[model samples]
Target: MSILMHVCTLVIKILVLPLQVAELLGLYQLYKRVFPVFIYNISFSYNSKMNDKKRELFRELLRFSPRAGPLRLLEVGCGSGANFQHYPSGCRITCTDPNPHFKEYLQKNMDKSDHLVYEKFVVAPGEDLRAVEDNSVDVVVCTLVLCSVSNAPKVIQEAKRVLRPGGAFFFLEHVVDEPSTWTYFFQHVFQPFMYYLGDGCEITRATWKHIEAAGFSDLKLLHFQAPLVFLIRPHISGYAVK
Candidate 1:
């Protein structure tokens, strides 16, 4: 890499490292209080590698999401607007995230026109969603968000409630893995730390079951593993028709 690039990378790492360290230590409230003040956008220094990884996973999701085109899309925790670029034409997007922190990033990276807007970046917890029209959305895309929500079941219900008939709910998430013994062990060990560091993400909750229980049909398991690591990629990416 060139000197300027190297220096920039070093600077970003320098800026983010403290928060990363704090997050891993289970000091989430502390991280939350300080993170917005320090680390505003996580993907500031986008490169081909990051873009390629994003495309691969995102493409994988689109391939699995049933009838993606011309759908009214709702992304619950859209961050940095990375997924906005890949939406098929005719798909109108409305993103609701709990962070107005990335408005500039979204404008620069994803907003191509007036049609797409981040209606409300930050919102009060689940009950606040009562305003979203019921059965109006054709698709609800949520990835890596359920892990952190205060109430996963409520969100799943909301996603289901807002989905149009024949609509699909797409998920690409890092969830608690199975093989009874390991799953149990992971629940016991990781729950406390993960809850704090990972945005109150629950490592043990059965999100699949929750989604299924919400009366959505056609559950498909795209992938899963016992331990979820970036390198290991123990992610579950799939969709269920609403």
Candidate 2:
């Protein structure tokens, strides 16, 4: 088993050698352009497979009524607007993503979901959301994002900053499993390959810890195992109130 795992890892690395070379040669623009297309294709199947679980979770977290008027939402790392269907009707959503290439796909999703109001898409990392005003949004949503960020804590802080007092930060992310688990062992083994193929996603991050330390007034986080690839099955989902 050990030898087989090593061989599989080697095979995966060999397949991604071109990506490694691109990075080494500073072909960042090419990487940025290609990654969104890669994720957009993969997300269709992934979303379909995780549809029930994700739909239920989104419904629960986004259930709250705003104090007044339509709910204002800011989603960090809003790749291809995957959560559009789950949002309540008349939601005013501002989408942000580091990759500009996703805007085209995002617009298509927005056009399909006419029930929700579409705000402009901003090209910004979650760690620095300077374009969004402080305390301006009713809810901040992040899904499958923390793992790829260079600094999870900074992203959470920015999320909290943009949310109105009493607004909520809703998050759903895959995290590292327990140390003794076989999944955890493999997560570490294939992490480098995943980091490249996934456009900086790190499977072994303990993302829940960053949220816990963000000083939310109230937090309700839970852990579960998603029916996904073994390396990314362990997951966390819930909300934190500012």
Candidate 3:
């Protein structure tokens, strides 16, 4: 197990080295902007697979959106439309993002898929989502997105406003691990560069605390981890029943 762990660590460092290098050079924004397109292109190649762990992280929330309520859903930061395939039956899935590229690119790519439910694609930021109507959506979903938003707290508040009573909010995010020494150290050391380059992501944030402040209760975390090697905080993904 120790040998395998070392091997995994080595592989991760090697793979992430380019990003680290780019981060050093202040080209992280360039990297972040293009990474989505690269992912879009690569996702089509069956050999370039979704890592099982990432799939598991997304699976729980994606699978839940279908059953949350009978109304509709609004997904904030629908990157590359990656979560589009998981919409529940008989539900309306409306997605929004500030990236204009994502607006057309995601639509063109995902439009061909035969869906089990109704879906709509829109271009808007979270704060302005009030145009969608109050208490109309059955659920608000955020996937790997809270980390990159300009105003995550405001977005969460808007999500609350748009959701109907007894509805649910689901999110899957990478967050800070308070318990791990290495995690805290790296986050402090690298967060400035990461923020500038990775679209305002905060490695030291209390994402769960923010969620609670967003007025969500009855929270249930399906999965979470805080081991060394820079925590991924997958437990950030869970349901907040309204």
Candidate 4:
């Protein structure tokens, strides 16, 4: 089994050699351009597989009174707007992502969801949400994002900063498995490769810790195993009230 794993990892590395070369040559713009296309092509299949559980979670977390008019929602790392369908009707969504290439895909999804009110998409990382005003949004959301950020704590703090009093910050992220587990072994083994291939996603990050220490007034987090690859099976999902 050990030998097989090593062989598999080698084959994966070889397959991504071109990307490594591109990065070495400072062709980061190439990566930025390609990654969104790659994600756009695969997002439909990925979302279809994860829809049942994610839909339920979004429904629960996004519940708000219509009496408040449209809810103001800001989603960081809003890749291709995968969560747009799950949002409640009449949400004024402000989408942010570092990759500008995703805007085209995001607009396509937005067009499909006529119920949602589209606010402009901003090009920004989760760590720095300077374009968004403090305490301006009713909800902040990030799904499958924390693992790739440069600083998870900074992202969580930014989420808290943009949310109004009593607003919720919703997150659904994959986390590292416990030590001594086979999955943990695999996660570490493939992490370096995944970091490059996933554009900085680190499978072994304990993202829940950052969220816990973000000083939210109330937090409700739960852990579960998602039906994903072995390296990313362990997942966390919930909301923190600011």
How far residue 88's Cα lies from its native spot in candidate 1, in Å, is 1.4
Cα lDDT of model 3 by residue, 55-138, tens digit: 554355443343444447788887676666555445567888876666655776466545534367677887779568888777
Q: What are the runs in model 4 whose C-alpha is more than 4 Å off?
A: 1-21, 62-67
Angstrom error at residue 209, model 2? 0.5
lDDT of 2 by residue, 113-157 (tens): 999999889999999999999999989999999999999999999
Q: Quote model 3's TM-score.
A: 0.70
Give all candidate RMSDs, comma-separated.
10.1, 2.6, 7.2, 2.9
Clashing pairs in 4: none
Q: Write the per-residue lDDT of candidate 4 for residues 34-112, one digit (tens) a residue.
A: 8888888887887887788788778865554335578889999999998998998888999999988999999999999
TM per candidate comes to 0.66, 0.91, 0.70, 0.90
Candidate ranking (lDDT, best to worst): 2, 4, 3, 1
Rank order (by TM-score, best first): 2, 4, 3, 1
Tell me how candidate 3 scores on lDDT: 0.66
Of the pair 1 and 2, which is ahead by TM-score? 2
Looking at candidate 2, what is the lDDT of residue 115?
A: 100
Tens-place lDDT digits, model 1, residues 71-148: 567888765565666566545677776656545555655546444544445443442466578988777888767877
